[model samples]
Target chain A: MSELLNTLMQDARVWQGHRHNKTTTPSESTGYQLLDNQLGGIGWPRGALSECLVDQPGIGEIHLLLPLMQRLTGTGKTVFWLNPPHTPYAPALAREGINLDQVVMIQTGDGGDFLWTLENCLRSPVTGLVMAWPGKLATRDIRRLQLASESGSNVCVLFRERRYTDQNSPAALRLELTPGDHQDLKINVIKRRGSWPGQRCSLAMAHRADLAFRETPQVVQGPWHQSRR
Target chain B: MLWLYLHFPHLLLDHIRRDRQDQRPLVIVEGTGQHVLQACPEARNRGVQTGMRLKTAVTLAPELGIVRAQPEQDARILEDQARWLYRYAAHITLVSPDGLLAEIGSLQKLYGGLPAVWQTVEQALDEHRLTAWAATGHTPLAARLIARAGKGECTGDRGHILRTLETMSLATAEFDAKTCTRLQRLGLNTLGEVFALPAPELARRLSPEILAHIQKIRGTRPDPQAPWQPPHSFRQQADFVQEIEHSQGLLFPLQRMLSELEDDLCWRQQDTDSLHLILQHRHEEDTRLRIRTSGPEHRADGFLNLIRLRLEQQPLRAPVVALVLSVKRFIGREAPAGQDLLGKSQDLNEAWHTLISRLQARLGDHALKRLSPQEDHRPERAWSASEVQSKHKPRLTNPEHLPRRPLWLLQGPQPLTEPPTAWFSGPERISGGWWDGERVHRDYYIAQLRSGQLAWVFRDVREGWFIHGWFG
Candidate 1:
């Protein structure tokens, strides 16, 4: 009975749903209340690699990470994107509150140079975050970048095609993004350091259209029919 | 009137062998002829001597490297040495072939004494491993003669200088052969023994040139020397004994040159923004790599790291025979970062600048950029990649309540086949580029498409609706 009282007192913090105080890393807030609550530190861990696996290229993948990127760049830290799949539309990035000046996009034709550049940017002391969408990579390549990002005040986010979801990753967080019901961005938390990883979050991405323009005009739809004829 | 002379008797050989990791048997010989001008200790151990025939030297040491001394290259290197010595003394003169002379009388108060200045220069030479013989004299001519004769010693008093000069033989004096033979016929052996004669008698025996030399050594004649001013830019090159096929092998020579450059920059308290490295190839045109830092940089290691990265990316196209490192864009450092009041610590801003510059070095100059908003309303022209540093927090006021825009603009607009199922916002009209050839007139809207994706679509006034971007 005395042992049970001591154990209960020691495990009181766990009873309150805050068991990870000692194991959780210090982090920057994720800016989303529900997601933050589910995370161990209530935010994204700093100085660790995170992976974002997506089903398609343009389903608001860049948007999911924009808030964190904006926070870092706003503090005069640079964010480097290595061999991005699409042209980094500067105007769109600026609209997301990212300082257009702080986004450094690196283009490399060779795979080796791409990895070397990613590692260098990750190890930089002034780097806020490093984002690379190198289509597919061996687990060791991601581990090398993870090691480089560990010693600095940086976060490395890797975006990969969704087919790579089965391979194990060394990233601190692995989020799988896909289009959900009603066009919401569905985020499946595949891996979260120091916490349980099976939770899904959906964020409403865009303003709903008004009733006036909801219907497709008969004349505007004629181009496809005309081409078919 | 104190003067210091630095004589580089083995300047060519030293330049050849200084940065080499292997201390092999090597010597510099006359370009046109086969006579050895200088030999390293390894060559000397093998019975190689100065003025020995190159063929005989080769027989003595089978692996001996015979480097032909190029006069023009030697003179330029001599001037380059003078450029660094200028950092120590304001008045510097080039003693051609392989020596430098600088007036150090005025520098005594600044450097504390002659010994301090001597130690400083000696430390620099030892650091670079350049072979030099230094001497101090009341006149430049006396110092040059003593240094050439290898009897370099600092004499504080005039009596001591005179006594030292008296010991210098007439054979070591720089007089012409005709005057030296005539002087020997007169039984004159040392400078003191020859100049002790009456002026009229000495004039009768020796030519006017020899008389002028004696007077100059004795500090009686007016000896004018043209002070050499350093060039506006710095360029230092080193040739390898063997052609270097690997870029990593060039770092040693580059190290010595860059640190010397760092010392030069420290003396002037300025910094350079870029380095122009030219690799001299054996069979191709010279390969040039221009390394630009994000801001002014003065550290040798900082410059070297960048070069290593670039060299790793682009290997030598052909075997490189030599390398020339030059820097012309000097940025005068402003009020340097200060230590805190309590004790010296690395300043944050300074550290960031170093980090940024180092990043710029490894990555090309274009790798790092800060954005500044442009006034143009065109979506493509709304921002510019400003190469300048954003050292401080941005002051750009991004006001709230502006019309929302997409975060991903397509490389080019994709035509929208059908109208959106739902329209959330905007009939925002955008019309411009009437002056330019590609005029655009459209009313843009943020609309939810049938695919449930919010797309940035615009209707051209004349044409149809097109999807411009994606709102994430």
Candidate 2:
């Protein structure tokens, strides 16, 4: 009777997935409370590709990631930036307490090199985070990056245009980043594993401070930015 | 010190004939394409002389194969031989275009005696099917002169060595024709007879250079030699007897070279980042490609995979006669602590290095760039692209302790005619560049812009507000 009860106990734990629908895999904090709450593991899925879609490029996208970037880079792990839209400002990264020397930038002139550099960075043990702005990768390539991430045990985050939301993706988690009211950063959870989606979060940056250096109102927006409200 | 000199009488013939299996009469001709520089035994037996014109050599031996002599090939082959001989002795020097000199004084204790070391060297030469005339002497010059005369005697006693050297013809002593004629006029027919004359009298007759040579031979003057160091650069080549048009045929020879390279790297405890492969084509320019790695690496399998991938990506344009693999950059290989107690990084670094190398090999150069800090106050000029490396121990210091700065700096500061919504801090004045001529005077501020981006904005005080960077 005791032996039969032991088998019943093992089976009982297996059914717990139905009630919680979750796992206890080791996690890294996303630094945003709302988004973390919505995630099954309560953080950005570690060792998986997180597809981040931005409706408009450079719309406080880096602001949303600074807290987590700060946490990872604080431990002296290298962060790889593959073909970023613009050169990463040293002062900005240094302010976040990231060791600037640890950051690596790979310039991919062609598509083959783009995928190869991304997969290589993802599979490296020293690479703590790999952020790439890729030009339309095929589904097979995305799957390859996913497999590479599992071995690398790193958070591979890909930034793409919001229009790609309709395209099929194999990323473990996907979100769209946009500007919210009051200059807040808005993030909409489009897809996530083992969880219901369509969750939204808005976080404020350090409040905008103005210096009385200019008198005209003809300031142009950056290329990553399309229009101002 | 006891020295061993190895003279390669027909090294040029031996080098080219290493590919031939049969006893075909062969000769290496001079650059002028007129006279024969060296000949094999078969050609020599057929009355083909070293100084004979090509026409006479052809007339003497109709079946003789002739290959033009290249000094570069000679030096390369000589150094290659030195690298092999270095295994037997620590001190080995390349006697350019012809031979090698090895100091076997210390090796006597290791090999037990002179005969054993001689046997070992002979066995190695025989294994490689090379012909060498070796002679031992008290000095390198003595050994070289004795070996060149083909009157080699294996002995350590000074008397026996000089006795054998004394009988060699004055002409065979390698003195110039004028020097020999002068020596003959003095009625000095033998080296022993010349040695019998007083040193001061001989010094008056011969050139200062010849005086030094004789002193070095008699062990009365210092004859220092620079020991040959195996070059950090690695180069190994193979000639495909048959022209190979297919890429797969290249892999076999490449694999052999890589295995030898791995053994070499293992011996040196170093790694290389780039491999240059040159495919020699007959009657065409050699096709050369530089195979770069994503990082420094020294593994045969990883390099072979990269080679295979590259070959597949870029097919051969023409049939290749030979393939040469070389590497000029090397870094020390740090020993890894294998199988840690946590089992977290069991050869993980090695695995990643192999992965990066393979990626670099496949995608080619410009596929990998690492960022390192540059010593510049200007944020735009504060960083440079560095190659990824294994000794990544946080090499760059941040500008954190200085005035508050942003995490992400723009490629170039964007012009903003309008002011920030609010200014939090900084009236920090930065002025410079009068010396280098790109003068700039700016009042920087930490401000929150209209778009809610906390930016590092600066006013030229004359040009207006510009959003220079962002604090994440």
Candidate 3:
């Protein structure tokens, strides 16, 4: 009976509750101390799928991945961006110390092609990270991506609309982002691999003084504006 | 000076058999479509024989498939067979219409022995599904005569070859009809009977051509052979007996052609990035499909997969009768950097190239792109999307630093109807494009909207506010 139990425990399908804290999968730091602490003392899970849920664009979502991208490209690893919402501005990426030569941008036509490109990138050995904006995905799609990432030993992050917050996923980690006060991003860890859900962490995204909201300039009457006034 | 000759009795018939999948009774008729030139084994099994009239052969085998023979096509097929033989022997001569003469004496040591060389050629013939009669002789003419008689033996012994030649009939000696008839009238039915006569007496009785031919066959005279060289580019065509109705039916013949191309590329130590596939239709214009790879590739599997994907996208419009695969440009193969000679671990660059090729094959060729910065200040012109480079170049450190830019730039600026709640910085003027006649004067600012979205807003000379980008 003990030998049978040991064999059963070796199978990945059997989830043991007591072995939660002894996770052996490697992970990278998320660059936020509070979020890192909430994520079982490690950062983003490596060789696994992670999902980021956001309602709108430009709310510090891309800023959250800058550190990982910089670290990856600095070490001669490739980063793939599949079907991004907008153009990945080159000057901004270069300014962040990210190697543009190591970056590849892929734009696919349909959902099938998007999924195929995503899976290929995740399974490629030379890939450091794969970031995609897969609009909607089924449960099976996410599971396959998770398996591919685990096999390739790379990081894969999928950005989805905030409406998918209630749907269950097989990702290693899931986070929901909303705007916070004073240019801060409110990150709510809805689900984690080895931790309880609903942990909150606020991260400051904008560090440049020129990006903060200041007093509005007074309106000046010019020749072109005279007609409008 | 040992010579080897390969005699293909049914070259066109064998070629047609290789293209199709069925073992049907087939025969190659003369150019006049009157007599049978060659009969396949399936047809011969049914009592249909060569040199028989077309009507007679059709009666003998009612289900026989007849294909009219063309001398031009026969010559081409013979040359293709010689190309295959070039890999085994260095000096190959194309004997037009159905034979190849190769000097294999020098290759005996290279291939270990005469038997080894013969075995190698036999295995290659079997692999290609060809029926050939091979023989070795002291002279080229001797080898040809013995092989044509269907009594060829893979022996390099001078005495054995001479004895075999002497036993051949006068007809198999390949002499002109006039000379053979004259010699037969003189009571010389076999080649040995003619050789027994005095040389001067025979030369006086017959024309000088027969005497010179005999001397050359006996190795007393030199027979110069023009060596055959492989063409610079690969081009081969497969003509079918039955028309292929579906594009899928073309893959069978295409598989053989692609493997041949792979062998050619490997032999040349080169790779190609483009392949042109032409399909000939019976009534319509030829359909052409061009397959392209991101980097140089020489694998047949990769090319076949790309062709499959392309065919799936747009199928044939008519029944195809022939297929032509050709590659014009050849790229010299370079060993991948940082890869060990033993190849214990897969090269990362090769993996990257494979992924890119697979994506491009399924998706269109222009789906993937590389982003590089340009020397321009206009937000729209600040970056460029170009083809991915096969080799990655290291980035240079630019000493000049530019101002802040957004993470995501909109394709086109949208007019801002709602005013921003706060303005952080503004009025950094950019006025340019005057030399290009598309002048632009704008004041850019960082503004915070009511929804807390950081926007890169610009005001034109007309005082119209437009949102240009987002800081994602």
Q: For this target, which candidate reaches the highest TM-score against the unseen true structure?
A: 3
Clashing pairs in 1: A101-B370, A101-B371, A209-B423, A209-B424, A210-B423, A214-B421
- For model 2, the docking class works out as acceptable
How many times do residue backbones clash in model 3? 0
**TM, chain A, every candidate:** 0.80, 0.80, 0.83
TM-score of each: 0.87, 0.65, 0.89
Predicted candidate 3 versus true structure: per-residue lDDT over A39-96, tens digit per residue: 8787888899999999877678888898999999988788899999899988888888
Query: What would you estimate as the lDDT of candidate 2?
Result: 0.76
If ranked by TM-score, best first, what sequence of candidates would result?
3, 1, 2
**Candidate 3 per-residue C-alpha lDDT over B290-353 given as tens digits, one digit per residue, 9 for 90 to 100:** 8887678899988888888778767789999889999999999987666677863346766777
Candidate 1 residue lDDT tens string, A76-140: 67788777765566655665677766677666656776787777677666678778888769999
- Quote the true-contact fraction of every model: 0.25, 0.36, 0.60
Selected candidate, larger TM-score, 1 vs 2:
1
What lDDT would candidate 1 get against the real structure?
0.76
Tell me what TM-score chain B of candidate 3 gets against the true chain B: 0.91
